[model samples]
Target: MSDLVARTGRLQQRYEAGCRLVAGCIPFRYRSSDETDVNSEKVVEVLMINSTSGPGLLFPKGGWENDETVEEAAVREAIEEAGVKGDLMDFIGYYHFKSKTHQDEFSPEGLCRAAMFALFVKEELDSWPEQARL
Candidate 1:
């Protein structure tokens, strides 16, 4: 797991150094899980975006400031890269790399493992922002 994280850091470095083009997104969904005591479920569509590769593109996110949480960083990234705005209800969960959906790009430090951070937010729009095209 450490190796995978290291690789992700390298990926960030590449994006910063003008080496990599692909950018990741922290897409979030809103769910009924927040309304506890009912044990019921609700489904809704959410929006996300991958950053652009060339000029006018925003920098890819990796590490955050010492006082911030990853959730905050993710939200900030979404706004900068996707131009979407919303509030995080809470952390939904994290998907480990063991899942079949895992994927990672090459990193200089080592190989990488991919993971998804699921967030539950309020009032997420289904439309993709114009900035999301890249």
Candidate 2:
């Protein structure tokens, strides 16, 4: 079994202005168009996971815990949800959204603010915490 484990619960979750603070990453990789060509065109591919709630794909994300920096949380989410490890490149931006399921005392309206980043995927694990869910 892998030593990796996904964090759970909202015990350390951060909230601000009735919005649950979240962090996530857009994992991507460069693929060579032709292996034979010395200067082959590189194709960019973004990684996405199957959403547990419905019929859609989503980037890895979760609550931004108080114990970790937003960048740490984003990287953690990628490993937990996508079973991939990578270098977090750039800060994409913050996005706001609402989710009834995420409603809690801190976020009565389920309002969420997600800080997203670009991650250059470096490793893909054959066994990860959430691999069974994939």
Candidate 3:
């Protein structure tokens, strides 16, 4: 038999589900991995939603909703917010943007693990749906 199974890791620490949170739909484009764009280029208006909780950078995201994948939700958000025809290109690596508030509201050090994916647009999207930040 072949080993064809996905692996998942459990949190190092336990916490109430109520304390957990998710924030996604941060529009990120492919930069060829060759060009170094350390500095952000607001040229493109990204879709970001502030947490209703307020105080700090938080967006509307969840682990699973009605069996919908994160990528699906992201794409749906982009289309609805930016009106862009985007297609999933590839999966990007994860990163840990550590912060005190993040640890408190989200989880421990690596609690707020973000799912970064690249979106290949069929064409230039309006990008600016309505003064949305990128």
Candidate 4:
């Protein structure tokens, strides 16, 4: 079987010479309601993927590569990790996080700045990269 894990060998870890940048999205879908139009203003439930290596839920995310825009990286991460595709609705916010396992030559502290977006889920795939393991 093919590996479902998202590959990050080509991704860019640094925003510049010293800054670490990451991109991610919060996938969400509107719950079924009496309204005929699915796009109608309804209650929304965020899609949270369970982590195999961690206890808490997580949104799909990864390094923002130098070859792609931030939006593209965010969408790609969502498909690879969450097995979902959607329209990015809006920019949620930026978060700074520290990782113990990510320390490298670029950043000794493993400090990272993440760009987060709100994704309006349009389709949920039956199979995706790492879908089985995730």
On lDDT, the candidate that comes out on top is 2
Residue-level lDDT of model 2, residues 80-109, one tens digit each, is 899899899999999998874778889989
Clash counts for the predictions, in order: 0, 0, 1, 1
Error of 4 at 86 (Å): 0.8
lDDT of 3 by residue, 67-132 (tens): 456677556544544445567656665444433434543354535455556665554444433224
Candidate 3: stretches off by over 4 Å: 1-66, 98-111, 123-134
Candidate 1: C-alpha RMSD to true structure equals 11.5
Score each candidate by Cα lDDT: 0.40, 0.91, 0.44, 0.80
Best-to-worst lDDT order: 2, 4, 3, 1
Quality of model 2 by C-alpha lDDT:
0.91
CA lDDT for candidate 3: 0.44
Candidate 1 local lDDT, 20-108, one digit each (tens): 22222345564675576466776575664443443443222333333445565555555544545565454444321121222234333
Highest-TM-score candidate: 2
- Cα shift from native, residue 65, model 1 (Å): 3.0
How does candidate 4 score on lDDT?
0.80
> For residue 89, what is the lDDT in candidate 2?
99
Displacement of residue 22 (Cα, Å) in model 1 is: 15
